[model samples]
Target: MYRINPPGVYAHESAMTEPRLRARVERVAAALAPPRVPVVFTDEQLPELIWEGRWTEGLKPMGTLPEVRDPVLVFSTFRFDGKEAERGAWFDQLGTGIGGHLRNALVGGGAFHWFPAGLKEDPYRKEKVCRACWRLHFQVGCLHRCAYCGYGGVLVTMVNVEEYIEHLDRLIERHPWQLTYLLEDDADVLCLEPELGCLGPIIEYFGTLKDRYLIIHTKSANVEWMLPLKHNGNTILVWSLSGPEQSRTLEPKTGTLEERVEAARLCQEAGYTVRYKFKPILPITGWREDGARAVATALTRTRPDVISLCTFMWMECAEMVRRVGRDRFDPHFLAAAEAAADTIGGLRTAPFPEDARAEMYEHYLTEIRRWNETVPVSLSTESPSMWRRFEDRLGMNAANYVCGCGPQSTPWLRQLPCSAWQGVERNDQGLRGTW
Candidate 1:
């Protein structure tokens, strides 16, 4: 970790009551290089910019600047009425803003709400195929500059974390069937840590729960601060992994593969269940050898309870060409995607054909099984047909399979039977009435 400042140094005294919590916030703030222009908001404007997709209007206030010379940290003071226990400062600052331009933003909103991921239909297949669960966002926006990713530039940190946890607790209580809460679908949350200081309390809060679990998804290796938390084995630390070439060329800003694996091992040793997600698996040149080697290396250090695999799915064939350049993808897959680009339209499925995706998944499965035969592996956000195709090979189907962040996939209940959803209805977490 970058030790920029001494421990527990606060630029300005915050109204946060708890000493330990305040200390954590101060520690994170101290680590960062102070922002040049510290802007604060006290209304729905920032939220609207993030959630309502009104960045053009939002950026109008910042003036027409080609690039940000000094890093800017925006803090939200709204809804923070004079209560000491409910005070915080929301800011976004990574390193110095060198050659950084505000091109686009993918800020996770400041609202505490449930997204019906299972209820959402795939754009390509036009059907509900994902596992039934709720997608929770603690904070929005990522700072990592992955070449293939366009979800950076602005990070919206929910300052009032106590209230966010309360809202989450109520949501979890209302939906008894929703056993797992998957976070970080929209952000690499840990990247904001020490500075954010909310993850620790949230993990401890989940520790007090019964069957409920918290799945924190990230591409960050910022786990030293979390190793001593009272997670009680309720928090599942999931790392979004990539092969050597992908990590090097594609995700240069994020942690290296070895760093992430070592972080997972540390978390696993600290009694937190660890999971690996080969999300957006790029089929670059020599991918099989590199991917298999990455998997073998990870397995050698830590034994993840479950593993999930997903092919590269963000950009279109032409979009990939535009964003990451045409040279990023494998020639074969790129040619096939280009041939089928017209038919695919604006759908968000993987760029490859069904057969190609299956081949990648099959190879990953074989690699995983070579190390651990019984570690529950499943596809992440894949279609029904693809799941069915590999149902036998995966040892579980989409109906009752244990994913990296499914509601019923508590660490204790490792392998749920196919009939696990016997009486419980497959209803969305946001729709409690249907169940």
Candidate 2:
């Protein structure tokens, strides 16, 4: 409930008095009123352990369970003067989710990127092969306790929202071909909510832009904060959903299946484009039934513009078992993964054979079609061969498919290619011929 800015912070005193800064700070504090959890502020990016310890101390009263721990929001106000020295510091502060080499590559440049699948010589190229899309990060770390993810325990957010918006405008103007900027693969940004108070401003900023759109990717159900914003149908909300069993066991401290779909329905009704991503779909016992029910819940409840599918594909089989526990996985999949462990060549992820993954994708595709056959369905982070296997059935290929968060995957580009739409401009009347 209280703002915790350490004394003699790196941010100048004038910044505290600046109308925009003060308004953002005060607004977030006010939103988190009747105080339950304390907000910590620091100019320096502290170690992850330090932030975790602070979060534990602040949320001690909430309970000892990881699910009950609402992370202590650390407002990092380290000023970036656009200098080389400070720029290095800025990228360094971008949490563990963004890697060191990637941080170096983004210096003095736009954070929006379509990451390559590495060079032919790269050893991990096979595992890394997937459709590329432009992604951006507003916050770095997460607050949720999903077993597959490492970004948890504390949420460190850069407080220069105005500065970021200004810079983002330039990035959008430069990349006229880019349609949507995914905000955030790193964190479940909305889980910080109205208390964070940054998303509203960012959403509105995208609303003012012409053809540019923002995709808010999250597993959190804290979307009431966005219901009132006039998104101008330029903002898309893609929920990283999972089956009921997986949500209950694997993804702790995140929204329930019903909660996420209901939130999607609300967002759709609010005139924002809504989408879903069954990411890392666990191949547990009764997975087919469970995944089908989840797809049904989403499709019947809310009309998603697109649905992207992804089988569980993170870390090696043994590593996942070690991290999430052996009992958490289905015995059949576990046995298959264990048997195939030594055969893993590229990235040790998705230990299942090609046929197993194809089965999973095909089952979900059938369930999706039962409700809405015409709705665009695509694969997420899948290899070229896998995409080719089902490309005919999906009516989408790796290159031209509408994705959960691709740069050119907006509703306007649903049926048209990016090249076809590029020649047209977005004016008061909208895109020439398309609109």
> What's each prediction's clash count?
4, 1
Which candidate leads in TM-score? 2
Question: Highest lDDT: which candidate?
Answer: 2
TM-score, cand. 1 vs. native: 0.78
* Candidate 1 overall lDDT versus native: 0.63
What is candidate 2's lDDT per residue for 248-309, written digit by digit as tens?
87776778899999989889888989999998887877788889999999988988888889
| C-alpha TM-scores of all predictions | 0.78, 0.80
TM-score of candidate 2 on Cα atoms, chains taken together:
0.80
Where does candidate 1 stray beyond 4 Å? 1-29, 34-37, 44-72, 77-110, 120-128, 412-414, 417-435
Candidate 2, residue 129: CA error in Å? 4.4
Model 1 agreement with the true structure over 277-311: per-residue lDDT tens digits: 88877778788988998899898899988898988
